[model samples]
Target: LWGEACATLETSVGPNNFNHWIKPLRLTGLESGIAHFVSPTRFISDWVNRHFAKDIIGVLSRPGQPVERLRFDVVPQAAPGRARSAASGSAASVRPVASAAAPATTRALRADLGAPLDPRYTFGNFVVGKPNELAHAAARRVAEGGPVGFNPLFLYGGVGLGKTHLMHAIAHDYQMRHPAAQVLYLSAEQFMYRFVQALRESTIMDFKGMFRNVNMLMVDDVQFIAGKDSTQEEFFHTFNALVDQGKQIVISADRAPAEIKGLEERIKSRLSCGLIVDLHPTTYELRLGILQSKTEGFRAQQPDLQIGTGVLEFLAHRITTNVRVLEGALQRLFAHASLLRREITLEVAQECLADILRTNDRKISIDDIQRKVAEHYNIRLADMVGPKRARNIARPRQIAMYLSKQLTSRSLPEIGRRFGGRDHTTIMHGIRKIEELLSEDKAIAEDVAMLKRLLEA
Candidate 1:
């Protein structure tokens, strides 16, 4: 009866988990409504008891072989080579009179050992727009932990554009659905730091054992691993091992994989091998939507304060850099208003965010951008500003027009006159064309992001 129960337990955990974890636990006894087991070491005993004891207990407490509870202890003289012979003795182990009817539930997430998850970054708080809708959807899919369409969901974009937020949101949602999930989330820098620490301590095997065994792995700002040869090498192997086991991986970066300088070619290849989604720069409406969402949360906190309309619109229009900065500005304004006991209005927005608005001032010119775009697309400078409707010239022209509207303070009419004396509606149409491409066309979006970075720098 015990042998049949052990076989059932083995099938429940799969071969890999059974061999590594179950093969070591020796059933010592079944007495006084307690089923006692011993492992070779405290680490193995604790790990098994934490991760697999519930299933093992369930099998042991079957109708034939019953046990009220499971207990694990370390065997000081137990040897790994002898576990095969000794663990079989567990088959002859005795049974208890009364058994615990309920089995232990799955253990909680191992989030404490890695980076901590911020409860506020869940999907409910994320504001979606055309720019970030794809990213948001992909993240939600990965969180579902079903048939993952993408192996490593790579999310890259400008700073404070919700890469990390989406990553955290995935972790939170996944763990919520899977209580026993071994979900690990941390920065690339922390991974490197631990990799180095493991090397110095000669516990590299243990480090690899823990990391490579997780169900889900998320590394934020993976671009940070660029240029560090040893860290990159170790991370590559770790990433491959997890993916080979069909584990889900989520990564975030400030730029797309190919654009990150100093990163290894093979790593880039592997990173891009999976689904790559970019959280395009926030649209004005998206920014306003985010402000409104955040303001509602703040209003709930400070019920007495009545916020005016133009304040959020003003901040959303002015602070165009990143979502982090935008949220921070609103939070700061709310704090100031609460402290002063005043209503949130345009004057308050101006006085409170004066410094941030200055920094958000336009940094690029339409002409400079046209020149840069011309050089990038291998066309003459005059082609950008001249009357040329050819695909080769027009595509780059529209890209430049899009960048102009995004990065410069030029009006549509002003931008049109610069583009071969075209009308404002032509410029608007061109801008709209690029906006359409930004979602459907990857090559064009990549080019625009690269050019924008270069011009900003």
Candidate 2:
């Protein structure tokens, strides 16, 4: 009966989730509607009870057999003088109980070394655009599960930009390509917790072996270990061991390696030795594409719901922060329409998402633009609004004029009043000059792009 139920569960949850959460469970007995199962640790037990209990009960409760509730107990280990029994209740729930008879894969899962991969985040679901095309290509190259030309593929970007999504996609693709390979993916915080636990229990050697033996190791949000000395030391060793053994390592963070404050310089250099890819801020076309893709998925779920034209375009233009916020706005709109049994229209959307629209409305001022540009170019604030015709001051002043025109709704004459009472024609010339240089000079383009990101952020 347990074998049959296990087979059914492998189909319900994806293989990765099943292997991580369900495969380590051992059903010892079933009586009086209480199914007793022994788990390697409390974490897996609680996770199964919360997420997969109903599904398991549904499959196990047949006509002749009745199973309702699940009672979990940690696996027992032999002590100094007392022999352990399978039915004994032990308090060692946090640490894993290793079995000599268990297979290597099952033992690894029992160790709880990694987090579950999200089935929704995969290469097929990822949308490609100019800002993220290079990152996407690099992720695909690593997912081939072969020799990683770039050992540790470092992906960094601002929030909601696709770092976690691409990380999960790589893990999924690599697992699919090499089913027998040992792939461990976890957050840096989890790494810290495990290291601390091992230190407390004198199992540091086991922890090191488990981490160093993996075929692929991925650590997300690595900036979390920046200031900690011990965790950083262990992580550096783990990183070096994997790279030296020709194993693949993938890492993600919110910023570039060198830019992460409190991080060790040696660790940053190691991270920078590989191919560093940044998922740039999403473009307008990219946001629109994401909305369209999400709308299609929602349509599948709500086939009868009607969405009006121009709604997506309006959302794409208004919600310029990131992909998550854009998708969330769309989701709220769909839910509002479905709950009210109303067709989605532009006015209805505006009415439904008034709060989101209001929050996303960033009224950038010309003064703010001038201040930011001056600081970026390392010029004085007075020089920004004063008569400084030197190349350094003049170039930044022109860039400030360009940004003010692009970001704010001020007229050219009104902007002229803010910049040392210059004429409207002077503002126009400065704006035009910057525009021409944006296409002709790569440095100016990069500077403008970086400034735009800073302002938006």
Candidate 3:
């Protein structure tokens, strides 16, 4: 009964978890087909009892096995090592059998380690716009594998710009094509927590063994480990181990590795080994495409709900930060419409997302507009805040001042107070100049359009 239950669990739960949690367990004795075992620690015992005990019982009870109950004894860790052969009569012979299953068990363990990759995040579902075309190509290449051309593919972008989506897509592609390859995906925080826990428990080797053995490892938001010295050192070593073995490593962050403040130079350089793909902010067309894609997905779940082209355009234009927020807005609208048993309309969307949409629209201030515009143009931060009359910096600075007056409800004198205490007439002149340039210059017209998009974003 004990052997049958072990075999059933081995096949069902994969070998890695079985080895880590189950293999070490000593089947002490059997009574009335009810097997009792000794686990090394209380944590492991409790975990097994919680998640796998029922399955264990189900497996044991199959074929009319008379297993009625299973029990565990948490013995002294040192004592179990010494008494293994005495406690389990066939332990010496069991060593080779357990050794034979170790590799297969480890393979099974890797299969269950991380969150399942989302099917929707595959390359086919990724919509490429100018903003993300380069990043998309780099990801495709990484997914194709071999020679890694990019050893550590570092993908960075703002929230919801598909950093995680691309990472999942790459993992999905790799696993689908190479079933035997081991892949692990986790957030940096999870990595840090696991490392710290392993260190504290004197199981650092076990942590390293788990991570370093994988054929491919992906850590998202690597920036989260920037300032933690111990975690970074441990990760740095794990990264080197995998890289030296010619294993593939992928990392994602909100910014370029170099720009990740407080990260060690060695870690930064290691990250730079592979291609760094920065997904730029989404363009309007990209936003619209994302909306259409999300709408199609929503339609799949709610086939009866109808959405109009004009409503999609409105949503796309209004919620322009990134794909996540856009999808969130659509989800809110869908929930509201479905609950109310009404068709989705622009008015309904506005009502359903009124608080978010209104707050987003109202939150722009003159200072916000000026700082954002100046940053977008790459003018000196001082030039934006200081008095500058030269055409190069002055022109962008004035445009920023003009945008502040146009976008925010601040009065002219109030706006002046925010921008180097200039007179209200200076604000007026800047607005007039920008207005005149917008009418005559195509370049200025484009700049205005670009600025509007950035400010709104």
Candidate 4:
């Protein structure tokens, strides 16, 4: 009767779901007018009790074999060949694979999740700044594998904003703690490729079984599967099955799920159901810190080379677009200086990164900023530099001044001359006022940030 009921349950939830979530469950036999089941861990037991308890009860109750209800318990004796890891309090290791090639079985699974780990992208190496602190914190929580941590951890941002890096860090750290746990980390493109391969070879059951049974599943650049309907459908079901089983899932994308066009509404809601964190573009201070950390590593290798003062500062100030670009510029600077035996001066930086500087060069002028700010605030362009001390016009003028100071390399006196012949001190004061308001006022900060992105874009 028990075997009959399990077969019925497997049909209801599909093959992959049953293999991953239901198969691990052990029926300890019916007792006290109620059926008792055993699970490997507390998470699995609780999940089954909440989601499938009633259905399982209905299935087990037969004409002769009457059962009142169902109950689940965590008993280590029921699970075999599993041992807990010291790194993670609740995690246990799985069976070891003999080789890297576990194709359609556990062989390919070893190679797929094993070699992609980047030792450099750990929590220790990741620098936390205002732009990325929230994303970092959320990633850390998910990595901890706490029961209360939100599922379907969604991280999205523009290029080089550390979205992929954070995702990789989570995988690396989680694997370290849960050495026995199955952590499948890959890009969405790879996911689609493997899915198609399974379909072509009629081995989808193997694919589904392997993917569905993992402890942690991470898909990077999930936006790639947006317009691909078949892949999205498969991923949607896989996602629902995992979430229903109380497993931890992590995803990364270039943009928010809702902003991604051609994606299913159901998938969007599922992705958004959990915590969503966005990493803002790198700031000046963050850029400097990153350069500092990178240069410290370089200094150990080349002790004879000298880095001139203001070199890193200039690079940080000039290269404001992406961290990847910034790191590349630093590498180029060090290589150029070492090969030529020249100090890493601002001139050397300029010469080595001339192409990048030209590409990311800010083209917005004082007038351009004034026009944009006026247009954004619905104010008169003439009033931007006009002698109107009214709050409405004066605030817009100050925002323009602040933008000119930030988005351009113009000096205070030069920017002041553009604004009705005001002194440089007045320009500095206005810039300071906006800077203070940036911390105090959320609306102003968002407006300024949005305007900057538009102008910069």
Candidate 5:
């Protein structure tokens, strides 16, 4: 019965933790529904009682015949082969028991759960820009904490916008300052997988205890937990427990909580309780800053690689969407130049990144124009395509149709077909309307210029 309880606890608390805490105890006997066990030292016995007693009791309790109590004793023997490190306390004492008794399956699962963080994602390396300054400030304040000013600091943004970078920086910062504070950083998929594993093994209490005891919890890409009700419910409780106790909780996702489809309203409201910062697409200046910083870092590694002055400006202006891609382009350029014994000039870069550069330079399609215009005007894609008499979708859709005609080689009917199967006459009318706007409104001309630059780049 004691062995079975330990197995159940192992499944719930995770193999690494189970091996550390429960593997060393000797099951002396069971009597009157009471289980008695002995540890190697008094410290181990007390630590076990403090952290795992309630969970142990819950695991041992069954439908009808359940263990009512647990007893622990300290016994000194030629220390068990599995002994906790003296510094790690009694938990480390159980190391041998895990080595001998732990299954290969358990070891593999533990390895899967022990995902190492990327070392490059430190606070020192993160570049702060106007778009992410508020998020950065909020994260800094949370890291230097007394009372929890924000229950759950939610950061959302498009891909490659440094959402994950900021979250890692926060975790690394807190861990360095407060070494004793328990920090658990995992993706929402990881959380859900662990929860489901615990459920299958009937060790929900163990699962609850693992997350509940943490002083800081950071979950990345939380939108993955949107439709899974059981996982979401468990996460909600874990979130509240940590927040109610004034512990720091941080989450990152691609969109705002409310905008995340299928998320529970209560969970969304809880997420919105504190600061919710959105990381916008990097501006040209911000991209240049990132490129300059990245180039300097690269230069330290390869002092001989000569990246010309206007190279960064050209790259920054061209690769405008994400910082990651920009860095990748630079890396590719450096590698190609170094291997081929060539100068890292604009011509070499253009050759090395020909595929990416070509895709970047390709003229905007009619489809892309419609999508971008609809997004800018805050109108639905369907409404833009539909015969809606409302000016909201109609005007923007017309502007998109005009841009497509002026920008691409598509004929009138072809352009119309791309915009909800309208006739060539409709396309002509839309183009005329936008042309009139361009002549009268400076704002419209500026918008056209910006869109053209974005599309061309």
Candidate 6:
């Protein structure tokens, strides 16, 4: 009866969902209008109950087996290499992959709930430059699988800056060195999800056991849990427990701990206690190196594709936002050439990636305009956004407002906010005054033009 219902669910919920959330469950029996089942973990059980319980019950509550409600229970896992006896009848049971057994628990958590680690994100493929050298070195030291001085190693940076790559590399290296050591890697979002599930199911103890039992825990994009109060509290305790037990913790976020708004100060202080490393934005040389490395790898797959000289360099120069965008642009070029049978030249790249190129073009920010305008007139930078009405300060402030309006994509209100919370009407007045000066006074026009050139440069 359970088998039939699951077959119907496989189609209803989709294959990936069925396998991850449904296949692990075993419906033992239906009695007294209640369906009883055994789940590998409370996390999966709670998820299945919340998301797919209605579907399962709907299918089971057919003509014969009437299931009024669904219940998911986590039974004790059998010892390794021991199959359950037929005598243990009626109730179906399965051992959790991350059982509370000695030594193998970390590998089990890694198998069951940890985010899938990318095989390509190892240190071997990580391109090193001055920007990321310190981060790479620190990760390498931690991955050496020794007792390190830092209890928690925090890596923070903007998107596509290799924070996740380093985190994966550390896990891969650490697991390889100590085969029996328990290592678990997952994102902060997953941590919160499991915590939420554990709370819902009254299985908080199970959740604590799974997390704190690991020898090493790596959580990526921890900034996601910033505003989540309960998750933050659980994470703080988990963090402290691991540190108290002398276990290693690796965390990655998009920004520094102090900079993440809505995060508790105590959590910030704990995260800051570690050796915090920032993976700086990629330099042109680093981007070129990455492109070259990627192209070399691509050559093995498409040996016939001809790439012209200076194409990689051109891409490196143009795609300066991050490494991911740089690699994605290169991949698009490869795909274009592979499909069209054309050589990948600079001209072909420009023609094929016009939209990307346009979007990646030099972006001017309000901060840049304000700073340049302030410098050009030799007034303090603070005065550009300050509450002052003097002529020297007010003139450059208006010029900055005019240039910001001209150069940036920001709305008037946003621009006004950037200039120390001035209103849009005030911004409009300042911009108009600058426009009147630009047309009538040659000096104002020349100053605006010169500032524009400097800002662009």
Q: What stretches of model 4 exceed 4 Å from their correct place?
A: 1-104, 113-115, 362-368, 375-378, 385-402, 409-457
Among all candidates shown, the one with the greatest TM-score: 2
lDDT of 4 by residue, 1-457 (tens): 4556667887887777565456666665566668765444434444466667767877877777777776654332323435332123211222212211233244343334322555467788788899899999999999998887988999999888888789878876775466446677789999999889889989788778777877788899999998999999999988998999988999989999999998999999999999999998887788899999888889889988789999999988788888998999999988988999989888777877888887776566788899999999999998987899998889989999999988777889999999989999999999999999999999999999888877764
- For 92-136, candidate 5 gives per-residue lDDT tens digits of 333333333324443234323323455578778888888788888
lDDT measured at residue 269 in model 1 versus the true structure, 0 to 100: 91
- Least accurate 10 contiguous residues by lDDT in model 5: 85-94
Q: After superposing candidate 6, which stretches have Cα over 4 Å from the reference? A: 1-110, 365-457
Per-residue lDDT over 1-457 for candidate 6, one digit per residue giving the tens place of the 0 to 100 score: 5656667888999988887667766666677778876654444555677788888888878577577898755532343223233223222443332333434433333345566566578899999998899999999999996766466899998899899989988877776565445567889999988788778978777678878877789999999999999999999999999999989999999999999998999999999997999987776688899999999899999999899999998887667676787888999999999999999988998888888776765467788898888888999999989999999899899999988877665779998999999999999999999999889999989888778656643
So what's the TM-score on candidate 4? 0.68
List all candidate RMSDs to the true structure: 13.2, 8.3, 10.2, 16.4, 14.4, 13.0
Q: Pairing residues by index, what is the TM-score of model 6?
A: 0.61
* Counted clashes in each candidate structure: 1, 0, 3, 6, 5, 0
Question: Would you estimate the TM-scores of all the predictions?
Answer: 0.61, 0.71, 0.66, 0.68, 0.61, 0.61
lDDT of 6 at 441: 100
Q: Which pairs of residues clash in candidate 5, taking residues 3 or more apart in a chain or in different chains?
A: 82-96, 83-92, 83-93, 84-92, 84-93
The local distance difference test score of each candidate is: 0.78, 0.81, 0.75, 0.78, 0.74, 0.79
Candidate 2: global Cα-lDDT? 0.81
C-alpha RMSD in Å of predicted model 5 compared with the true structure: 14.4
| Candidates ranked, most accurate by lDDT first | 2, 6, 1, 4, 3, 5
Off by over 4 Å in 5: 1-114, 361-457
Tell me model 4's lDDT, rounded to 2 decimals: 0.78
Against the true structure, candidate 3 has what lDDT? 0.75
